[model samples]
Target: MALFSARRGSGLAAWLLAGSLACLLLVLVDASRMAEERTRERAHGRALVARVGLTDLALFNEARYTRHLSQADRHAAFQDHPGALEHFPAGSLAGPARPSP
Candidate 1:
């Protein structure tokens, strides 16, 4: 009876250890997946910003050309536009609508 009890305790301990390890592995996997998702989301956001910037620049250039402005002048005009400058935050990843000091 003593030997049987000892064997049973060892079996239970092994099962608990295995369950704990599996839980840890699952947590680690979930963390890794979250990290990857965040990275992809950031990349997608950058792509979108780039696309919008390019489109805005193109439209501005077309308008400038229609008004007979030189290429350099058009570039300057786009930079001087308030709406274009506010597309991104001053120094953060947040989008526009930041409160003025």
Candidate 2:
């Protein structure tokens, strides 16, 4: 059985490689299907954008201040008080608002 045992390891490696290739092929097929769906979605998104008119996309819904950074009032963060700490988790993600010229 020594001769058979020597080939057993190679057999397992070959099966593993074949299984990996099969998985890769499945992923490629799925990606191709998603690509077609993405093209249709892109066209729908363009239509929505045109109908809605140009507006800044809201990134964070956690707080009003973070909802529209470009239009955010710098002093709005201290609406509660002058020394209030940032309570919303999204507040930390945004940097200080730029001062208007």
Q: What's the CA error at residue 71 for candidate 1, in Å?
A: 35
Query: What clash pairs does model 2 have?
Result: none
Estimate the TM-score of every prediction. Answer: 0.34, 0.57
Off-target runs (Cα >4 Å) in candidate 2 are 1-7, 69-86, 92-101
User: Could you list the CA RMSD of all candidates, in the order they appear?
Assistant: 12.8, 5.4
Candidate 2 per-residue C-alpha lDDT over 16-87 given as tens digits, one digit per residue, 9 for 90 to 100:
887899999999999989999999988887888799873556568667777776667775655565446678
**What local lDDT does model 2 show for residue 14?**
70
Candidate 1 vs. true structure, TM-score: 0.34
Residue-level lDDT tens digits of model 1 in 3-83: 334368786777788789999999998998999999988897679868775332222323343223322333333354523
- Model 2 lDDT, residue 32, Cα: 82
Worst 10 residues of 1 by lDDT: 87-96
